[model samples]
Target chain A: MKIFELGKAKSPWILHYNTGSCNGCDIELLAVLTPRYDVERFGMLNKGNPKQADILLITGPVTKRCRERLLNLYLQVPEPKVVVAVGTCSCGGGVFRHMYNVENGVERVIPVDVYVPGCAARPQQIIDGVVKALQILREKGRALEVPPHLKKIVRGREGGIDRESLLEDLRRR
Target chain B: MKKIKVNQEICTTIPMGSQHVALPEPVKLVFDTENEVVKRVSFDVSYVHRGIEKSLTTMYDFKKAPYVVGRICGICAIAHSIACTVALERSIGIDGEVPDRVRAVRMIGLELDRLQSHFLINGHLAEVCGYENIFMHLWRCREFILDTADMLFGNRVQYDVVCVGGVNRDIDEKTGTRISEALEEIEESIGFMEEVFTRDKTLVKRLEGLGVVSKDKAFEYGLVGPSARASGVKTDCRIEDDWGMYRDFGLEIITMTEGDALARCLVRVLECFESVRMIREALDSTSPGEEIQLRVRDNPKKDAVCRNEAPRGELFYYIRGTGKKIPGRVKIRTPTFANIPILPHVMIGVRYNDVPPLLMSFDPCLSCTGR
Candidate 1:
């Protein structure tokens, strides 16, 4: 790892993806980044490109048609990533939970490290959720730096958690 | 040594969105360009569809429809809620007229909603033009309005402020005073931004002549809201409808002759100032302590169409109510859906690079379109 990797905990570029949301949560998510809330003070950047992002901030429920594109975006982001599901719908499809076209929530398609709950999550709650995501990313980054044999002893197993199977079970539920 | 096939016109394609920095909502625009001039355009606005209309009719009852409709478009939630409730109220036919206080409160919510939306669009258009400083300043100024909204109502975005018979919330003298002060502050700051937007050489040069839409083309494309008003349509639902308190308030329908991006921006800016004044006027005219709601004796057994001027344009809500608690069918015609037909027409003949700013000028909300 380069010496610059030490700054990973402070500066995490976020990828914001809207997956068929009503836009209530998406606008609130944007609110957290503006000067009023100023989440940028923590060095969090909203990077539209997934490939260059370190954390994925997803708003809205995972609609059937948008699931593939969303998953593709998640896969495009490099590893040592964290996913933060913002809003009630993004967590469990708040008002849009029962619509036929919706897949319920984003967690059904991707593993979520943190879930921020609100009809439209308040900017304060979103900023808190992002702060938590930053901590999780730091842990994931540290896990990547550790030797493979030591990683098992330091954490739990050879690998962290299988997010794909976890996502499948979440969908089944 | 290379052989070229001659005699054919060359056209290239540029796929713009679905998840772009310029557009917060999901929409994909495909532009067919001939040597950097757009020949045609196709839009994919289904990315934000979440079966809201189906849910409105099947899953939720009529009384709950207003709150549900508010979720359809976060930016226009207050407008949707007011329109949905008014439609139901018309169909239900309560014993007496809707209380004057209720109408005034609803109007305040709507005007506030439009205020924030206009501010947001102005900032977003600035951001799309790569003017981050102006975007930040505009949003910073908008925060006062959002804070006032949060103070008067409970939430910022999905304000469950409007209900079936009347509004779910009310404002006190203190909150009203606070809102007035906030509006004064906002107007001062936004006036500075309006000046900057008009006077800034780069912004003016980029937006002045680009994406020109003639009045004839605007009418032909069936444009609605600010997009149409910018082209001198001289049409607005509030002016035409006498059912609401707007007629009593006597608000003017603002229009401009130029149909370019700059004209649209000016329309939104001028409208923001007007909305602030309207809210102030509403505060004075409304009687205090009047009952905000009336008890409905029965469900609406008829069909009614409710139209409101949302931030982007005119939003039409068509509801067919049975004798039951649930509605039979709920059809929504959002402004973006009506405005989207003008997209290809406006984007044509403009450079490929101007597509983003031109599209932002209309401030198309994809959630409204798909829902």
Candidate 2:
């Protein structure tokens, strides 16, 4: 419990990956770190290598060729990590959803904890999403706090929601 | 009789990329060489063909078309937006001129883009010449231009300023003053840059007589913007077409007869100064008014051809609407594609080591070509 508390307080390092976006979303992500937004105050730093990151911040809809590379990179991030899907494109494949050439969104391939929505999400919203993801990380330890009735539905014999089925349903919708 | 003997067996073809340092964006180049001298260069630019034209036809409604089309070229985003809107305006018969403030602000944004892109290309040229100091100085100065752009358009590179009928953003007194001050500072800095560019013997020697495009050859190859102007050809889409504020502003088209890499460099540098002046002029007299944009009335019917002078060169947008929200056919022809035809002609008979600087002389953006 003490170790979990320390890890939560320390704040996780982040890695930014661009699947196949027009440079629009890519530049805005950098703008978040610039002097104006100064996202560093929250202790989030962009790590070039995925092995060192605790959060994977992905922009752009997943393109065909980038999917394998993206998955390989995702696997490289240490376990119990959270993913923040930034921008409308990554959320629901905003403008590029119907391209037929790309995975609909980042969530299609990866488990995303928070979704920040914008044509390209504003920097403030992106920061808020990351902070919210940190809160989610802290709450996982209190799984026992769930009421008896809800616990059965959540931690059912199958142990909570089947993310794959949920994603499939989303895809159909 | 004595006849010159030549062997075709010795000639070799050299391929430079869809991934090469010479081109900033992805495009493949296959060059045939004879004795290490390039003979012919062919372009293979299908790498990033995202089927943008097809998507414009099927995906976007006419109302949503502006934002979608704006994504075609990040470097020339504003130009695409303006051209599409103009084409739409013509098609729907949306008569009555856009208010003076809208016109002026649009001009300011367009010129700011031109300044940033020109400065960036010039910096890249200096980098290719191995003049790291000039490159750094130019880019550092360019930061100011980018910041100004960010202030004006909300984003630096993709400048989301142009809407369907008018502009998305307006310039109030506060921003107008900031822009004027920034322009003055950049204008001041340009003097020092000019000194370095002119006095640096290494830069001058590297660029002088490199990739010379004679006036006749330039015309024959269909060179556009500063590339053609370097060869003393007077052609600029803004000047020729009189799109928005160009006719009112009375722009002085810059031309040079040297037709070398240095001339092209100088033309772009001078154009940067001219852009600052134009922005200043536009800002001073222009006053904000209501209605930055009018609601799009109807979808275009006949094929509409629109063109503009982007920072790189001439950018053309062709759209055909079939009364549906989406366009029937959308075609984009960028300046880099037009300039690519002349690369082999310039490279042929030139030394192998000189290939990089010569290739980058046009400031090629392969993304535009591939798109």
Candidate 1, which segments miss by more than 4 Å at Cα?
A2-4, A148-173, B1-7
Q: What TM-score does structure 2 among the candidates reach?
A: 0.74
lDDT of 2 by residue, B201-228 (tens): 9988888999999999988988998898
- For candidate 2, what is the interface RMSD? 4.9
Q: Against the unseen true structure, what C-alpha lDDT does each candidate score?
A: 0.83, 0.74
What is candidate 2's TM-score for chain A? 0.76
True contacts kept of each: 0.81, 0.10
| Consecutive 10-residue window with the lowest summed lDDT within model 1 chain B | B1-10
Residue A134 of candidate 1: its Cα lDDT?
81
